[model samples]
Target chain A: MSEVLVIVPVYNEAASVLRSTLEGLRPLNHDILLVDDGSSDPVPELVSDLATTVVRHTLNLGQGAALQTGMEYARREGYRFAVHFDADGQHPPEAVDALLDEMQRGEADVVFGSRFIRADNRALIPSFRRGILILGKVFNGLSTGVWMTDAHIGLRAMNRRAIQCINLRENRMAYATELLWQLRHHGLSWKEIPVAVVYTAYSRRKGQSSWNALRIATDILLRLIYR
Target chain B: MTPIQLLLFAALGAIALIYLKLVRYQLGAVVLLGLVLLTGCIAVYAPDLTTLVANRLGVERGTDLLLYTTVIFLCGIFAVVYGRFRKIEEEHTVLFREISLLQEQVRRGGAAT
Candidate 1:
């Protein structure tokens, strides 16, 4: 078994996009687990021949729930490390190697992929998203008490302890903040490494909107009250 | 004795019955629902008493007081439902995760370890 498991959380993504993503990671030889978040499409049959494990939600849970399912699978299956790779084809497959390399160093239990750490990466992000992310950084810092250069980046990697300790309660966009909060609460060591994000028109269209930030903030507040 | 009062009392009685059945195991909920039912009976028969109470509470009118309380009650219900909805969502997620994991194990022809 490969030491690292790549956990891809896919929703209603097109078959073509998912194919490209799986194809990119095929050469890496890492075990891949795709948590299909109750897609109405024929995702299972479409990727039936791929050498990856698919755990499917019978109902539509959000991305956070999907990732949590992946983590649980990894913990049970005895993977030493897990990478959160998007099936939307925005995350770089090569970055998986970067993340695993950093994770194996034993310095940090979790490594976050940051698109703003380098100049070229910073330029690639659309300005509106940049503004939202800056605001999100401050918002997350105030709420989660952990701050980083990026907020809500889909690409992240973590080791076994981090995987075992992190339990995500927020089932939607708010999980990004909740993950940071868990990092602090669990006292898991973390570092941010620059990774390239390819913002194709497809990803840009499918990505979070500026208005959704407000909804995410509201979710965090509600969790505080209800929890 | 009036038409509206008669209608309200009938409605309140039905609601009280349902509440009693639903919350029989929850002592606190039973007490709260009983108080609400008592208030509903008083408001149905003696509307002026609420106006007097509303005056003591510094509200101008009993109808306005009822409106405010109704709004507050709805907001409380909304919060409770939201919290419970989140809990139910979590439970569903667990069920889905377990089913998916078990299904995978079954497909692999290996018993879950």
Candidate 2:
């Protein structure tokens, strides 16, 4: 039995695309937790037969909430570690080992996959998109007073200690910044692993927009003031 | 009434109609209506209300008081909207957990059966 779990938070992704990504990860030898964030489509139905646990939210609570639900389930299931995998066909399935390796190093409790730190893949990150990521990092730093490369990247590996110690409450895009805040609040050790994202035609069409970067900043700023 | 006065009333009437139709909460609708009337009075009788409010509050200008009050009101609205969203989110999370737990129970029960 795989001690590690992969959490894929998806919202309204096409079944074909989601299926292909799940299929690619079959070799990872880890349990999969598919959190369907109140998808209006038949997303859960499409992956019902896969060797994965499908969790559904009755209401659309956004990506952060989905990840929290998945990770919580993983921790409760007695998994040693959990990786935040995107349902979109962006992250390479083979990179799971590199991320899992970092967790096994016993040096850091959390490992974040940073695309900016690795450029080996033929990933085509648009200039404007890269600028938005930098702005997101700046916003995150301003919020939590901690800075890290690829603050907005979705792929991450967290050991049981990290998951058990951190509490995720952000319900939307603000969860990214909230994760960094939790890392600081719990004094958890972390490392950034160089993982090359596979930029595909579908990914370029679907993904967080630049507008969302500003909104994430706004959300985090509001939380800092009111929270 | 003058043509400008008639046009102003028409615009205000249209806004009130839309507000009544769109607002879901009764308390919210009442508060919004009160604000609309307050703004109308401020715009039309600024000198009188401003003078009275400024004298009572010890403010130099009514515009400054209005600006400050507007900022405070906007922040209050932001807090209310954000709090309501958080409340709904938490409740939904509870519901999700209940359903997931039930699903797990049913699976285990089926396996036992």
What are the lDDT figures for the candidates, one per model?
0.90, 0.81
| Candidate 1 segments whose C-alpha is farther than 4 A from its true place | B110-113
Q: Which candidate is the best by TM-score?
A: 1
For model 1, residues B1-113, the per-residue Cα lDDT tens digits are 99999999999999888878877758898889879998989999999999999999999999999999999999999988888898998888888889988988787776334
> Worst 10-residue stretch by lDDT in candidate 1 chain A?
A42-51
lDDT for B42 (candidate 2):
55
Local accuracy of candidate 1 as per-residue lDDT tens digits, A1-227: 99899999989988989999999999999999999989998478889988788888888889998999999999999999999999989988999999889888898999999998999999998898889889999999898788898869988999999989999888898998889888988999999999889989898887777889999999999888987
Question: Tens digit of lDDT per residue, candidate 2, span A55-136?
Answer: 7777787889889888778767788998999999899998888999877989898999887875653145777888788778
Per model, the share of native interface contacts recovered reads 0.85, 0.20
Error of 2 at B94 (Å): 3.8
Q: Give the per-residue Cα lDDT of candidate 1 at B16.
A: 82
Q: Residues B17-102, candidate 2, lDDT per residue (tens digit)?
A: 77777785489777979786667645554446765787699888777777787799889888898888867867777677658646
